[model samples]
Target: MRVLFFSNPLVAHLLPQFPLARALRGQGHTVAFSTAEVMAPWLAPEGFELLLSGPSAEEVTDEVARRTGADILFSPTSQLVGAYFAGARVDLSLDEALAAARYWEPDLILHEHLDFVGPLVAAVLKLPSAAVATDPALEPDVTEALTAAARTRCLERGLELPSRVPSGRWLLDLCPPSLERRGALSPRERIALRPEPHEGPAGPTRARRAPVGDRPRVLVGLPHAAGATAGLGPVLRSLGTLDVDLVATTPGDPGEGPGLEPGRVELLPFTPAAELLENVSAVVHHGGSGSTFAAAARGIPAVVVPGSEAQQRQAEPLAAAGAGLVLPPGRQDPASVTTAVGRLLADPGFTVAAHRVRDEIAAMPSAVQVAEWLVASVSARRGR
Candidate 1:
């Protein structure tokens, strides 16, 4: 099988798919990736064929805006309304995907559910594709809410109402049903893959964790997407007052940001996220699907700060599992960030729940099993 994937750029976005990619490669399927050029260096070592989809976040955003006349800012809410209209400028991304497909001629397209172009691209090419959600889409209510929100965004963008919306062939819900109230899957969908384990170096064990003390070690992840940064000065100053050591995952040049001095905060680029989760007592992240899941997989409690609706929706399951705390931007303050971090470290129940959920995620079938399932699902559908 020749499989192609379309996803957004960011280390976390690519991490969950690694295990599946490796699994497919191990099964002798030719796998190709179409993502930001920035991700190519990191993904090259993993042995999958790479295709650069778009040049910069702005270029992609501009193209999406030009193609659909949808304001980029409205993407957060517009993504749910319908498939024809997009919230973000996706023109270049859509073009790149079509261009890649022309040469790759994939047997199937496995896509991130929110990419917006995957289903359309698949339809145009007459190929079968499945929606692999890094978060929960099993809840019809959530999907409906997204649809309505998206519709509102389109109306604001001056785009016409979409006459048709392409339905996905299958929905790959990454979350376990236990955490969701409406977790049941349709006969068309299959729950096959769980979050894959960190294949990178195992940093340390729970027994090796730093003793609870005044300077609690905290891991902070800022999503690499445009406009995703929140002012960290206030948070850093607050944590400084608390005598905490901060390790922030900002790619390169730690001293570039305010209050992030050499000894106090380490600014490192692209350390495998799984490896970073090992030493930290708590996490402060942008609530991206992969980052949230990575922290949950290790049983490490987190503070999820979401600026977008997709991120807002992604935080729900972790909140439900009692594995992490969600703090939206309008609600964020130095006091809130500090309080959330402090509480996550002090609460024993949170840790226990996080660990239990991690175990559940770990127990899901290996990536090999998931790849096989994806292929089988596509083949069976074609036969019928």
Candidate 2:
């Protein structure tokens, strides 16, 4: 089987799907993963074919800066909503992504549906495609409800719906089921998973902090920060003042604001996250599916500060399962972040809950099992 996977250029969006792609390839399927130039090298060592498009990193940074500055006065919610709508209209990169898809002549097109161009490309080529949701907010149930309301909106722009819902043979709800309260689906709708990342290496267990004098370890990340609220800097600064080893997911950005001074934060740029969370004491993040599960696989407690409705949507499960704390975006001030961090750090109960969920996730099926199910579905439909 030849599988062509389409993903946005964002690192978080691409990493979770790599395990699934690698699993398929290990089973002797031919798989090619495509994304913008910024992501080419990151996916290369994993055996995925790189696909470049649009501007280079410098160009994207410049554009994002100009746009962000121009829109900074708007509320974060407004700025994000405007950007999301604008992106659907101007996808110059889609042509490049589609060209790569055509080159593969794939048996299936797996994509992050939010990219907006994946389904269009699949339709044009008459290829079967499955939406690989990176966020629990886009799980089948959420999509079903949103799609029903969005049909008129999408049709207004001349978009055509598939004859039926794009059958998500395998909806990779990357977050532990407990961390996605409203987003959790029936057992049949989700791919069962082991507590460990099947394809990735194990996580860490300790760290030595030079800047603040090593104390305990904390994994700090905001994988969905590209267009989300920019608030991690202050939180990082406050945490840096504490006696903890602080490791941030990505390198510091100029506009990310205070608390990212050199030696204070460890930036794990393009490093696979599953390998980083193994020995961390806890996580402080914007409730992203990838980060949530990466922490859960190790039974690590969390302090989630959501940046959008989609992120807030994930807070329910995390709080319900006693796995983490959820602080609203507007309210995620220094004190709130400190309190959440303190609770996760001090409370042993949270760790116990995380371990309970970890045991359940570890017992679930691997990506290989999910891939086989997807193949069978596609084959049966073709035979009909």
Candidate 3:
């Protein structure tokens, strides 16, 4: 079978689909990507056939900002979601994406949750499509907003909208039920896949074996999308005061910051959080879905300093699950960050909860298993 995958140009958005894509390829299906030109380089290294759908991510972001008159980085979740769907600039790539879809004529369309173009093309072509979750907490809202936007766009183009919003057939859920937003969407089918930890282009280079020492090891990682490393310095200084050994992946140059205590904090360039999690006892991060799930998959507790409303939402469920703690909004300073890390380290319950969540994730079906199901589902539909 041939599958067409669509995603926004952002690296974070694209990484979630990799495991499944790889699995499908291994199963002897052809998989191609439809995304912005900016993503082409990243896709080239992975050997996937890339069909250009739009301009660079930077151009699209700027376009969205120009159309909405809001900094997407700082905008509220609702505003960002609404703007992303309704903004004229966001749709600039749709015409090309549709043309690519028509040319490829894929048997299946699987897209990252935020890329509405997948569903729109699927509806127009009367092809099967599924929405793959990137951020579990945001999928419902994304589905609603994208569905409404797609419906309007379809009508304007003199086409009928699909019965469902983003997906004509299924919602491919990678997150465990416990972590996802309750009743986010009423999909015709929900396919559960184990959340495999994969670090795409930016993953760690050499696997450093677990830090060999008596002192507990803690990892501090900032999300690339966060775009600023200013907050990391203070947090690093605070973690420096603790007795634990600290390893941090700085957003920018690690040398710009004030010197941390020699053995207490070690700052390095961006490495995959999953790589670092293998050696760490606890994590302090910006609470992106990838980081949060990576930490959980390894049974590592986290202290989440949410950088946005969506991150805040992701953090809340992790904190509630007892796997981590969320630093209150505006309390992401040195003192608060230090205190949360201290709590996670000192408390045994957090470790216990982390392990439980890990076990839950481990119990889910692997990506290969999900690939089999996907193929069977498609074949069954064809037979009918």
Candidate 4:
């Protein structure tokens, strides 16, 4: 079957759906991604076809700022964010995505839940689509904002997408049952789709970091929306107080602050999370679904410092499961970050909880199983 997928232009939004896409391909389904050019680097390496659509995230952010006269970068409201995803983004993306889908003639369409263009494409083509939830449930305001804006944009385009995207069809839930917020999805078929760390072109080998030795090793990451972040220098430096050796994937130099032991922390350009997590005792990162699921999938405890509500949504569940701890945006000072990492490494119970969550994730159905289910659902819709 020809399956086409849609997503926002960021890796965090796109990577969560890779496992299922890979699984669908493994089952002999031809799949392609319809997204912005910024994703080409990620999608190409994964051997997936890139059907370029939509503006890059940075462009969308710029557009939003222009339209709203407010920069919602550090602090964003649902309305402004929704304006980008459902309003501005739709205006830019719908035509390109529609063109791609028309050419691809896909039997099924799947998209990240927040990506507005997907639902509209499905509506215009009169084809079936599924919403892939990258994180646990979003807050009601977020969902409603996106839905209302999407509805508005569709009217502008003379399109007819459903009011509630996931409710209109399937919701491929990536969150394990233990961490899922109940009733986030409608009474639709919410399938369990396990999350996996997106591997490099050549798999984990190409991205592996050097071996660590002696003291406990900790992995650190700072993601700015999608890739590694450069803003965690204070937190990264504070780790010097601990005995653990550090490896960090940060975009820019995380200059060492006072108290950080020099040469103990190794910094690199964006490395795969699976590679960075190898032989590491714990993770310290800004909360993102990709990083959170990577840590959880590996039974590695984490210290999540979230800068936004979206980040908070992904962090809270893991912390609730006792697998990690959260440091809210305003509270994650150097001392607090240091303390959180220290606590996770010292307490064996955190590891125990992490493993329990890992076990739950393991018990969930594989992507291949979910892929088969998707195929069946599509065939049934065609009255096959």
> Which tens-of-lDDT digit does each residue in 29-93 have in candidate 3?
99999988788777887789999887766676677788768766566456566557534434787
lDDT of each: 0.66, 0.64, 0.79, 0.81
Instruction: Write down the TM-score of every candidate.
Output: 0.75, 0.73, 0.91, 0.91
| Candidate 2 C-alpha lDDT tens digits along 62-131 | 4544665544223434333334322422244557766777776788878764544566666667777776
Root-mean-square deviation of Cα positions for candidate 2 versus the true structure, in angstroms: 5.8
Clash number by candidate, in order: 11, 6, 0, 3
Pairs of colliding residues, candidate 4: 222-228, 222-229, 223-229
- C-alpha RMSD of candidate 1: 5.8
- Spell out the clash pairs found in candidate 3: none
For model 4, residues 1-384, the per-residue Cα lDDT tens digits are 999999999878888888889889989999999999989888887899999898898898898898889876755788887787888888989899999899889989999988888888888898888889887777677777777888787778797655575434888888887777665655577788887776665766544555556788888776645423434566666787788888877555545433456657777766766677788889988877778888888999999888676678767778899999999867788798889889998899999999998998898888899899989988987995
Better of 1 and 3 by TM-score: 3
* Alpha-carbon lDDT of model 4: 0.81
Which one wins by lDDT: 3 or 4? Answer: 4
Q: What is the lDDT for 38 in model 2?
A: 79
Query: Who wins the TM-score comparison?
Result: 3
Task: Tell me how far the alpha carbon of residue 338 in candidate 3 is from the true structure, in angstroms, after superposition.
Answer: 1.0
- Candidate ranking (TM-score, best to worst): 3, 4, 1, 2
* Candidate with best lDDT: 4
- Ranking 2 against 4 by TM-score, winner: 4
